[model samples]
Target: MPRLSLALSLLAVLVPAAYAQEAAPATSPKITVDPRAIVDSMPQQGTLLTGLYATQATIELCSVEAGEPATTAMNAHRRQLESEMRMDDATSAAAYAAIKGDVEKAGVDCAEGSKDRQQTAEVIAIYSGAGATPAQPASPMDPAAPAPSATPADPAAPATPATPAQ
Candidate 1:
């Protein structure tokens, strides 16, 4: 019938318009990391990572803990971890390179923040050491000793950002 065809035609035209209207607003979803939280967390996590790598290295290098072959394998793994840590450090540096803009936008003062944030930020401030606050009187780590990268809790996981509180 003509009525049926008209109805179909009208629906065909309206459907696309309706879908376009339903689509989300164009502004990219705001990423809501509390820069202070990240700044706070990094120090504790970084220190733990450094300690773990140092222990592993010590155990590997010592003859008492492992046999020659075992030591070799451990050394190899330790090297791999160190390499990964270097990559992570680089990534962290890159991430923090942009920190000033992001942190200020995220509403944190780079100079004085929370105690936890300060602790974490101190490490970064040391890592950066480009006239950042609380200048490093000494290097954070010994030149001869290196640290390891952080391994994920679940390798298969794609980390999901947390939803902001309403």
Candidate 2:
């Protein structure tokens, strides 16, 4: 019985292959998806979702140097994208997976780091809903880093200098 079943299955496969070979001038149209078509047909906020995927993919690629900021940025983007996409956790996760697949299939690399906070066109084109990037570490020489207070510490000082020493 096993042998018969095996033979039938082989015959079934072969018959279809043979018929397919004879049936068309064109080879089977590759069932490939067009990145543009996929992006264009997405529902509102889909682009942002794709951007989220791009960000995740980029962060993963940059994992060797990924720091707290990158992680925070990725998380924040995810939350916003989730809210905008209006999907439950599981569904949003699946949607992100699909976006990753589509972006990868289109040969867009998401792993490169930005000197500045601006996202790449490929990322933006697919999803422009990113409100902000994560905060990077304060540079040692960066003026943005707060300077130490000029005033000397005095625990006994009054609550306010404006008030008399009461």
Best by lDDT: 2
Instruction: Give lDDT: candidate 2, residue 117.
Output: 24
Q: Give the TM-score of candidate 1.
A: 0.21
Question: What lDDT tens digits, residue by residue, belong to model 2 across residues 78-141?
Answer: 7876887677989977876777676567665434454312354334333334434434877879
Candidate 1 ranges with C-alpha deviation above 4 Å: 1-52, 57-63, 87-166
Q: What are the TM-scores, per candidate, against the unseen true structure?
A: 0.21, 0.38
Q: Residue-wise lDDT of candidate 1 within 109-145, one digit each (tens)?
A: 2243555344443333333343236434545475633
Clashes of each: 0, 2
Q: Which 10 consecutive positions of candidate 2 have the poorest summed lDDT? A: 116-125
> Model 2 reaches what TM-score against the true structure?
0.38
Evaluated at residue 51, the lDDT of candidate 2 is 62
Query: Candidate 1, overall lDDT?
Result: 0.50
CA error at residue 2 for candidate 1, angstroms: 56
